[model samples]
Target: MSRERLNVQAPVHELIAARWSPRAFDARPVETEKLASCLEAARWAPSCYNDQPWRFLVADRHQEGEAWQRLFDCLSPGNQTWARRAPVLILACAATRFGHNGQPNRWAQYDTGQAMMSLVLQAIALGLAAHQMGGFDAGRVRQAFAIPDEYDLMSVAALGYPGDPAVLDEETRQRELASHQRKPLEEIAFAGRRGLGFMVPDSLGWKAKVGQSACPGTIRISIRTWLKPWSGLGSRAGGCSTWAPAPAPRRCPWPGGAFRWWPPMSLRPRWIGPGGWRSGKGWR
Candidate 1:
């Protein structure tokens, strides 16, 4: 059984929530048909303007003599530490120019990411484990593979069956056993404006499980603490309200009787010229 499962905030497809990256991969050769199926899944990924920009350079350890070693050597030492156990290595790349117009395709990398995700998900569905690594010698990969300048080497992936945790060293094994985690939805989802968090109803059964003490003034905290005050205190105070432990005097209003309350400066919604709400910040 897989050691880790997603600690998801809300319900998700079982496949999606079950998929995870593991450093301990069994030394078993993945079937050729399975590899082809994973690639086929990537082939169908939607790209910008229907320009399929993704490409893959595969090396099977069970096949030819030096091909697998070449690919393994291209990986960074830290990645090679565990990735070497996998029976397959794939070099994911993308064409920088649009095939149709030959113009620089800024979306190439983004499209390639989607394609890689498709490949990963397919591998997961096939009862395989795939771990993508950004730590690699791009220059070495290009030189060794004779890659054209038009292609960008995006990432490397190690694919195989899940292996024994005992095969991994203590530190890696510990990480492999750790629970899967993600940022709370309150941190990512936004309301009417940026920085204002859209509170997911408690009925959804989603709550912050991770300690956020390190980031006291983050947008998530600000929004969670301020949204209620903005609506409750602002409306009752005749427009805007400041957060206070005790009742305080009402602050001055804007030009058009718009209530202005003191909240964290970062959480303040931008006031556009009459009838528009603008937020100067961008969400992640």
Candidate 2:
């Protein structure tokens, strides 16, 4: 018999790197406090005009009234089987109008995306997993929850621990149950134009351009680039404002001594010498 090459493996940094959308969930119920924490994390995301326009309708199987069933009814019958095991089912919604400003906000969808990311990361940190579902009928969800016309249903999320994938129905378990892959970073991030390779200054911190939107071509770089050494740690771009850190280290000489090593973990690309960062706005 031939032995399997167990030694051939993807790095853990890459293994934990991928996100899973599990249809099968353990029956273990999540605590309300934990769920609240997840939502609170979402609440802090940065939105265009600082207009946080996301709301969550959370349902748990343990609820006494008909609310649980109501929420479940919102999901397609196909989703009912697997999702029923998810202790918590959350409906993500975004307001169509931007706050009391009354005009339509171009970034509301982007902002909601930022919020959902926050919630997902928080769940991961809490040792919980969440699967964001786009399969549900949005119109049915709106009607079942009595969600108002002002809001648009974004997604349905199933949250809990992982269960045996084997238990899933043959069709679902085989079709989309496997781990998925992310597009290469090169395909995602770009320079001045779609093909241009650009670098971000270490001082400006890390910023991830969101979605499949093309690069903005010529984003205006923030003018005040005095190279504060640790300044980059403070300001991150994208809808990820919540990820920004508070008051960076005091303006000391740049760290890593003479080498000035750029951490590979920094998502932001590197630039030329001092004051070499580029910026613009149009992609998306």
Candidate 3:
């Protein structure tokens, strides 16, 4: 897993850093209890109005040989070229409508994605490898499993222990060895408008578990021309407006320190100001 870990720009949990999809799976079959734990983690994922719309159909190579082959048959040719080595296969599905209201729940697929995330993280926590893929025949799966039409297929994940990359083809071996990359934080999140990059200072980071230099904040988007600039609090950096924090000798999270940035519970942030600011500790 160390090879999978990349030097992330910001601090993230070891579980997240270590988690990566590997096409190479060991010959050893995944443990049943571990699979159950992964499902339990997914079961607790948050959903729209707690609808819990996700369902998982699991197939084990050692136990459910016939069922596993049915799933394997649905995979795209390229995916099957490698996925055949995995010991466990799972299909994630989401309800098309809310069970109670019978209305279209557009966020069902999103919530199912959250559940998959939880399951994958739990898999990594338990020293297993989990890889999700979208290359599969949805119609075939519905036909094979006799799935109800009310449910929409989300994705499929392969689960097992890490294996030797030597077995893979040249191109796949290169890809498996290559470092995985994610888009910069600025690219995905915007300050106010679409394509506007939201920036975060390097000093600001989250806790590994809890209470370890974590500085979480909520940011507000507004045009700078309409608001008064808080003196010595923050500057118009990257075209984002800055605000002042009241009360003397308080911690100014962004008082023109290493980088000018801030986020808080409300628009009127009471955490950043002109005085008593520490380098990393925020308020002195």
Candidate 4:
């Protein structure tokens, strides 16, 4: 476990574990092609009615053209302190209404967020680190960018190659070094009811139970049969796989001291990892 990777509870695609926002960015200029590929990834993100409501105003520090300074100026002082070092800045915005119908699209922001997630993940795959900031002045952004009243401000992102943590201020450095936190699966995922815990096998202490049980051969056979179909999932390029092999099968203690199988993987999962991240290195 390198310091850069997140300490995830369960197995995850190496890319997701690798993604993180860093305040200390190397001042090197990002290539235009890399930026274009990132937006291209965002362009394909799924949206309600395929509205593709997300839009971006990009500022390359090397270029410094087209509202680049205006975008930087809108950032709050606290953010500006660190974002100044970033080689690229992006203004994320949302079209508030449907392009086809002119009626209000209630999911505009939500859809735009999906696009941003795609964009950010793409950035990570390219060996770039992106940190989105809510500290910018939205009103200032609207005026400075000459954005229409129909558009809504989403966020500002600072992007560049990762740099030394030592470059950050003491407090910021500490925050960057701290392990990323996520709520336990039970707290977020529910079964039949909203509050009911959906126990993931990793959190269920099932593996330890399986190890203690006398029937090791049965457990191996059952798990192997369950995961056989997905043994090589996400390993090939340009394939149609839904998930990247998560929440594998586990043995669980059933009622009256009997053991049972609960492979929530049957429900499947999200994410087709970007092809580049599947093979790219340099995230360290």
Candidate 5:
């Protein structure tokens, strides 16, 4: 099967770039060893204080009788529309309290997210597609599985081989073919201070272009560049502002080095008018 590849500005590992979620799953059952390996990957994920608070409840469609149907029933109707064909379903949960001291583990949910990513990446390595879904009846899951009150049921995942996108409805089929995109670096990253735009530096040997649309007072700046985060920005630093122009540079309290700026093509700033925010061009 042809896998959809990511359009990354900077180089990344092949496994990270190839990973994606698919709505259509073939009915073939995942091998027991492969499933175990996926779970094993999740088991090894690092967690806060090594709490290992993540848990999983799995159901395979090949299982006898209502075992699979019970899981299927927990899915929302929209998810059920495509997820019914998936061969395996899993519910991810996290323990809310620490085992030793019984204190609240604030990082439980975040740790569970890391574990789930490990599982998904393992599945991708095994040539299986794992799609995590938030659209499920959590109450139904708790009731069906006899989950303890201390556990938070976070999400459901569908796992199996990739299926033909033609099996999906027309609207979903189009979405399956759509390219993945991310917001430009300038929109999220900053240089000296908060609300200041960091232009890509030419010394990095990369090109950058800014697209803009204008209104009466506000302008939206869309930066297209191959820039990555250098060091940590200040905690209070804001993202691209919709209301104002780039603020003057100040002595950044952050000990990290300054951002190298490079000049490239034209960048148009979008304007925000009284009617409403006007549509503007952005990185694709």
Candidate 6:
């Protein structure tokens, strides 16, 4: 028997299942309105005390070519080598304090994450793909971008359409181009704290069976339009996915298909089944 958990709502499964991380991107430019709409979605995301601490410093790939190059230069030599081809790059940062009250809020990081989530999903909704990188050199980024002392440097994001994964060199094409998967449900969602065994609420039980998944604030977009398809959240899988070129050319010539990078970036094989990866027409 497959025994794979069937507990996730159809929509929730779609969203969680569709999301992926990538290193290769087309050099094609993203339109301004699409970018703005994605940011607007993030702007409306719910926040603690409505602080909305997230701020973005975006370098338009073509217009700010020099600035973009500088940002790329700051990346670890390995990332700089390939990220040069990404169409858009953004620096995600968070304010140090809450807006309503001057009290230092420690939730800025979490709130920023929410905003980025909104950004990524919005990109997905806009027929675009976004890659988030944590393997950056903070000091170099801070120095190269003149990032201030106050805001915490969160992530470097690359945005563009899916591209030919074969563009990666032989060694890298084999290793860094492989797919990634998430942790199992049992290790993430808990009925109680760590070391204390617990079960999930029937209401929240899907997470326990499928590992940590989407938050209530997450939204789902149908293939027909970028608009929100669900009004309320009770645990619905978001039916979302992005398309990439076929992977046959991307497979490693080596065993396990593993290749290496300095602080090797993780690559997730994109989901390409029903309501998953698709082309200009019909659902796959």
Note the clash tally of each candidate.
0, 11, 2, 0, 15, 14
Instruction: Identify the runs in model 6 with alpha carbons over 4 angstroms from their true place.
Output: 1-13, 175-177, 192-284
- Shift of residue 174 alpha carbon in model 1, Å: 1.3
Model 2: lDDT equals: 0.57
TM agreement with the true structure for every prediction: 0.69, 0.62, 0.70, 0.70, 0.68, 0.66
Per-residue alpha-carbon lDDT of candidate 6 for residues 182-276, written as tens digits (9 for 90 to 100): 45445566565785534322221111111112321112223221222244643432223212222242243211222221110112122213223
Q: How large is the C-alpha RMSD of every model relative to the true structure?
A: 16.1, 14.5, 12.9, 13.2, 14.6, 11.2
Over 80-187, each residue of candidate 5 has an lDDT whose tens digit, in order, gives 989999899988999999888899999999999999999998987787878899998889889988999999999999999877777999877667655555676576
- Rank the candidate models, highest TM-score first: 4, 3, 1, 5, 6, 2
What pairs collide in candidate 3?
218-264, 252-273
Which stretches in model 5 have alpha-carbon errors above 4 Å? Answer: 1-7, 188-284
Better of 4 and 6 by TM-score: 4
1-284, model 1: which lDDT tens digit per residue?
Answer: 12322223333443454466889888779999999999999999999999999999888898744888998998888888888899999889999999999999999999999999999989977878789999999999999999999999999999998777679888887777665556756678889788887663222111111112111111111121222234344411112211111111132222232322222222223222213332322211
Itemize residue pairs with steric clashes in candidate 1: none
| Residue-by-residue lDDT tens digits, candidate 4, 124-177 | 778787999999999989988799999999999998887776688988876765
- What would the TM-score be for candidate 2 when compared with the true structure? 0.62
Residue runs of model 2 more than 4 Å from their true location after superposition? 1-18, 175-177, 197-284
Q: Residue 47 deviation, candidate 2, in Å?
A: 1.1
lDDT of each: 0.65, 0.57, 0.67, 0.63, 0.65, 0.58
Superior candidate under TM-score, 1 versus 4 = 4
For residues 211-251, write the lDDT of model 3, one tens digit per residue.
Answer: 11111121112211112235665532222222211111123
Instruction: Compute the lDDT for candidate 6.
Output: 0.58
- When summed lDDT is taken over every stretch of 10 residues in candidate 1, the lowest stretch is 213-222
